[model samples]
Target: MTMKAKYQSVLDLGESLNIQNGSVTEENGVLKVKGTANTPYEKNILWDKIKEIGGESPSDILANITVADESVYHRHTVKSGETLGKIAKHYYGNAAKYQDIFKANSDILKNPDLIHPDQELIIPNL
Candidate 1:
């Protein structure tokens, strides 16, 4: 499929990417510990069960989660032979969202089928 055609039917599986933990593992001291149990209790003992398994702070772990790109308000330069439907799929991942793209770029895109190369168009994330 052409790049523009491929972009005309865009979609993303909202899956979170897993990042391997950056914890050290090795033999240390007399016992040669492989990994730390890291039990931080409220009173000298680790209480958060979630941390014991994940070994990362909530915010730090959440930061690694993959998220779809969302545009608030923006502009896009039309490449050769591109259509608003294609642009809609490129940004919103659904050709049905072409109306959204048209509404967003109405200032420049007077016709849904009329787009010119190198022309600037507005893009609004919905």
Candidate 2:
């Protein structure tokens, strides 16, 4: 198996990630995630999801994946020729952080082998 896939599968065994569980009921323009508390993670994660899926129909990304506890992760658009090591050095200032990125964004990035342009990834600071 690839490194990214291995890391992601490992994380799946640890904790469950949160997503919009068809919990939001709207009449006109009101939207809300039912049975949820308001916290820093609530705001940041919501905004992040919206931004990543901008100007389009409902893709339901957060709905299908695990929800993280803290929203310390930042988003990165994959550029051609970009590698996990490069992303690690750019964000965490250490090459070792690539593994964290790989772990955080395994949904779309199933391996550290190669990332494509225009693909968005979540790079966790922690």
Candidate 3:
């Protein structure tokens, strides 16, 4: 199978993620993919898809994925009944880190208990 055909799923994923500056080429049984994901989570999604298709470390694929934003880990749009603790638990796997999220978004969040629907909160890097 050609490299391009072999890594077709990755290319499709890049498209689905709306990757910017995306380029794909295949040479000598190796596929090279380069793109910029809008967020770190989006980049992670690409990597996870690559690993899923290629195994732990696939030598046939060379992916250059980048995040467009570096300051915030994720920009979460708050939903009704969502608290800092819930958001912290979702991102960091620890509800206790709510304070960390609260502190990072102090400019927007006045209290840990007052997040409303549609509010954008910055999930700072830990």
Candidate 4:
């Protein structure tokens, strides 16, 4: 497959993430991609997808993904029935990290167990 076609999913994901200043090109046998992700989490996910398809340290692709926001890992919008533990698990892979999330959002979150839909929480860098 052509290099561009091989990494099409990564391009689709970048589009879905609304990556800014995105560009994709294939030169010789290598694919080149450049974009700015809104948050570190988005950039990380893009890299993860690239690795998943190309293997760790694959030489087939070169991606230049930048993060627009580095203050926090990500900004999560709470949904119905979502708890701090669930949110923490999704971001940090550990439900026990809920306390960290709670602390980062302490200004708006009076209690860790009391989050409502539409509330934006900062998924702090751990």
Candidate 5:
């Protein structure tokens, strides 16, 4: 398969993420992908997808993913029945890190135990 076709899923993901200034091109046997992700989390996911398809250090693809926002790891919108622990676990793999999230969002979160849907919380860089 052509390198472009081989990495089509990565391109589709970039599109779904609404990556800015995205471009894709294939030269010879190598695929070139460039884009700006809104957050570090987005950029990391893109790289994860690339590695998943291409292996740890595949030479078949070259991705240049930049993050527009480095101040925070991600901006998470609270969902129903979701707690800070769950969000922390989703992002940091440790539910105990909920305190960190609560601290980062102290301006909006008065209590770590109390959170509502539709609240925008900053998942700070650990």
Candidate 6:
């Protein structure tokens, strides 16, 4: 199969995710994909899909996935019933690290327990 056909799923994923500056090219049976994902979570989704289709270590595909915002590890849009501790646990695997998230987003978050839906919080780098 041609490289284009082999990696069509990945290319489609880029489109679905609205990846910025995405480009795909095939040469000598190798596929090259480049794009910037809005968040680390988005980038991880792409990698997961690629690995799902191309195997754990596929040599035929080369992907250059970059996170658009490198300053913060990720940005989380608050949802109802979510707390800083829950968000911290999701990102850092430690509920005690909620203080880190609270400090990072002190401008908007007055209290670590008062996050409301639609509020965006910066998950600073560890």
TM of each candidate vs. truth: 0.42, 0.43, 0.81, 0.97, 0.97, 0.78
Q: Pull out the clashing pairs in model 4.
A: none
How many angstroms is residue 40 displaced in model 2 relative to the true structure, after the best TM-score fit? 12
Listed per candidate, the RMSD to the true structure in angstroms reads 17.0, 14.4, 2.2, 0.7, 0.7, 2.5
Model 1 lDDT, full chain set: 0.44
Tens digits of lDDT, candidate 5, 1-126:
999888899999999999999999889899999989999999988898999999999899988889999999999999999999999999999999999999999999999999999999999998
Write the residue-wise lDDT of candidate 3 on 1-126 in tens digits: 888887788888889979999999887888999999988877887888889989999999999988999788888999988888899998888999999989998998787888889988888888
Q: Model 1 — TM-score against the truth?
A: 0.42
The global C-alpha lDDT for each of the candidates, from Candidate 1 onward, is: 0.44, 0.54, 0.88, 0.95, 0.95, 0.88
Tens-place lDDT digits, model 1, residues 1-67:
3322222111111111111221222222111101122111111112122244335543212221212
In model 5, which range of ten residues has the least summed lDDT? 3-12
**Pairwise lDDT winner, candidates 5 and 6:** 5
Quote the lDDT for 94 in model 2: 91
lDDT of 2 by residue, 8-98 (tens): 3222322243333324333333232333222333444544444444323433222223344346555678898989999889766798788
Residue pairs with backbone atoms closer than 3 Å in model 1 (clashes): 39-46, 40-45, 40-46, 41-45, 41-46
- Write the number of the candidate with greater lDDT, choosing between 2 and 5: 5
Clash number for each model: 5, 3, 0, 0, 0, 0
Candidate 6 per-residue lDDT, tens place, 14-89, comes to: 8998999998888778889999998787788799888998899989899999999778878899999999999999
The TM-score that candidate 4 achieves is: 0.97
RMSD of 6: 2.5
lDDT of 4 by residue, 9-52 (tens): 99999999999999998898999999999999999999999999
